[model samples]
Structure formats: C-alpha cells, structure tokens
Target: MNPVIPRLARLFLIAFAGVVALIVVVQIVWINPGKRCEEAGNWWDWRGRACARPVLISDITGRVIDTPEARAAAKDHAASQKAAASKAAPEAVKP
Candidate 1:
C-alpha cells in the first residue's frame, strides 16, 4: 500500500467539499433572497440587503409619480408615447 497515494486522495476530497460548501452558502445568503424580493414585485437592494418599492417613471418627465393621480397621469403618458412610436414607425419605412 502506498501512503502518498492515500494522502493525495484525502486532500482532493477536502478541497472538493470546501468548494461545494461555498456555493451553498452563497445561494442561501444572497441569490435566494434577491430572487424572492423581485418575485414579490419589489426591488432588491444588494448593498443594503433589503427590498424596496420600485421607482415609477413617465418617459423623460421629471414629475413625481407616487400619488393615485400621478400614477394615472403616468399611465396616460406611457400610452401617448406608445401611440407616437407606432405612428413614427410607418413613416420611417417609406421607400
């Protein structure tokens, strides 16, 4: 029986186990939480390790879109932008 062969085999097994443990820890601590946050319709703040509401936007307009009225306005603004884009697309395709 060769002693050197057994020692090398043991070292390889230890290194492989360490790598697997590291992967499991990362999945539990970081990956899973971020996925759950997004699935719940919230933003995952990686630096803060917390979930937050997403910021609403209405094209290039700088108005705050937080209230019910503002949200309705944002929805209208988005529809108008979509209509404008569709109208412009046909003009650009003319030969």
Candidate 2:
C-alpha cells in the first residue's frame, strides 16, 4: 500500500474525467449543429452559428438556373432601398 501511488491514481482519474466532460461538451455544442446543417442540405456559417441556403447557379447542361434578369431586378430593388435610406438618413440627422 504505497501512499504516493494512490495520489497519482487519483490525479489520473480526475484528468480522465475532465477530458471526457470536454469531449461531451464539444460534441453537443460544436459538432452536432454542423452535422444537422449538412443533413438539411444547407451551408453552415460556423462563425455566425447559422444555416443559410446555398445559391444555385446553373444546371448540368450549362443552362443558367439563377437568371440574369432576376439578378438585375434584385439589384434595382436594392439600389432603390439604398437611395431611400440615404434620403431618410439626412432627415434623421437634422435637429
């Protein structure tokens, strides 16, 4: 019955428990969300911890799926919104 051996064994058990707890936390917090996101066919933003739909560009035959006209319309709409915001910003700054 060596006292030093028991102390070393206790330290090893504590270290082992800490490692297991850390692994469980990592699996729950970091790994599971990314796995779920992939299974749902969405892009995972790791830094933001959010899932986003991927943009489809074209089909296998080179036919464009995301049409140019649709893009232009979106651009025009964005420009209009930006202009409106800018106009409101000046009014908001007035005393």
Candidate 3:
C-alpha cells in the first residue's frame, strides 16, 4: 500500500509536467493577431487585413455626406463629450 501511493504520485507529477511543458511550447509558437490592424487604424479581418467597422462604412466610402464640415462637427462633438465627462467626475489629486 505504501509503495502504491508513491507510484501514483510519480505518475501524477509526470502528467502535470507534460501539460506544463506543452503550455510553454504553445506560448512560444503563438502568433499574436491584430497588431497590423491596430497600426492601420482598423479592425482585424479574418483574412488578416484591416477593415473598417460596418457602422463606419459610409465614412470609408467617401460619401457626399461625409465632408470636411461633417468631420469638424464630429471632432467638436467628441471634445464636448469629453468636457462634460470631466466636469461630472472631477479627479481628486494628492500633491
């Protein structure tokens, strides 16, 4: 009975080590996706290409409605949203 316990423990340890080694090997070989897509300022498509979100399809298409004025308006709207958020949550700074 005493010898059986040690043999079982040894088998369990070997199996655990094998699993750990497999995990390390997989991590070394893993290729991270979406780095190129981030650089291109778009989402990573399945074909490894950068693609605009469906909601922004019209903007990407350069439609007549998407003019410089519209872009400026969008920028101004974003700035106002940020300002409002900051005002709502004033951070407490310790100097």
Candidate 4:
C-alpha cells in the first residue's frame, strides 16, 4: 500500500470538488443581462448599458393614435355618435 498515492488522489478529489462547487454557486447567483432584455418584449431596446423601452417618435407628438386602424375606428365612432344624436332629436310634427 503506497501512502503517497492515496494522498495525491485525495488532493485531486478535493480540487475537483472545489471547482464544481464554484461553478454551481456562479450558476445560481449570476444574473444574465441579455435574458432580462429579451423577456421585456420587442418594444425593448437593449442597445445601451441599461435595458429600456423606447417611446415611438409618434408618441412624443401624441400622434400614436394615427394608425390606419385607429383612423377607421375614429370614423366609425363619429358616425355612431352622429346617428345616436339624430335619433334622440325630435322630428317636426305635421298638423
């Protein structure tokens, strides 16, 4: 039985265990920046150091409601309101 061989094997095992523990710790505690940005959705712009949601250029001018779909909706809403108003109005009575 060689005592030196057993000692060397024990040292190797200890070093391996230390490395594995370090790797596990890093995996558990590390926060991935890219993952958070991706989860935020397509509106997020992750170009800079911090993750942020950029406002559209139209948003600044309060024109974000000017999409084709919105315009159509506005027209439909106006038509309905006009019809409602007219319905509530009294018609002329012919005596």
Say which candidate scores most in lDDT: 1
Worst 10 residues of 1 by lDDT: 56-65
Q: Give residue 32's error in model 4 in angstroms.
A: 6.5
State, as a TM-score between 0 and 1, how close model 3 is to the true structure: 0.38
Q: Please, what are the lDDT tens digits per residue for candidate 3 over residues 1-95?
A: 68999999999999999999998865544323355545666565645443554355456777654588998987898799989888867554433
**TM per prediction:** 0.56, 0.52, 0.38, 0.37
lDDT of 2 by residue, 30-75 (tens): 7899899989999888878788887644444576537889879877
Model 2 lowest lDDT segment of ten: 56-65
Question: Each prediction's Cα lDDT score?
Answer: 0.89, 0.86, 0.69, 0.71
- Between candidates 2 and 3, name the one with more favorable TM-score: 2
Ranking by lDDT: 1, 2, 4, 3
- Give candidate 1's total backbone clashes: 0
Best by TM-score, which number? Answer: 1
TM accuracy, model 4: 0.37
Ranking by TM-score: 1, 2, 3, 4
Compute the lDDT of residue 59 as modeled in candidate 2. 42
| Model 1 lDDT, full chain set | 0.89
Model 2 clash tally, residue pairs: 0
How far off is residue 41 in model 1, in Å?
0.5
Residue-level lDDT of model 1, residues 1-95, one tens digit each, is 98999999999999999999999998988889999999999999887789898665544468656699977987898899999999999999998
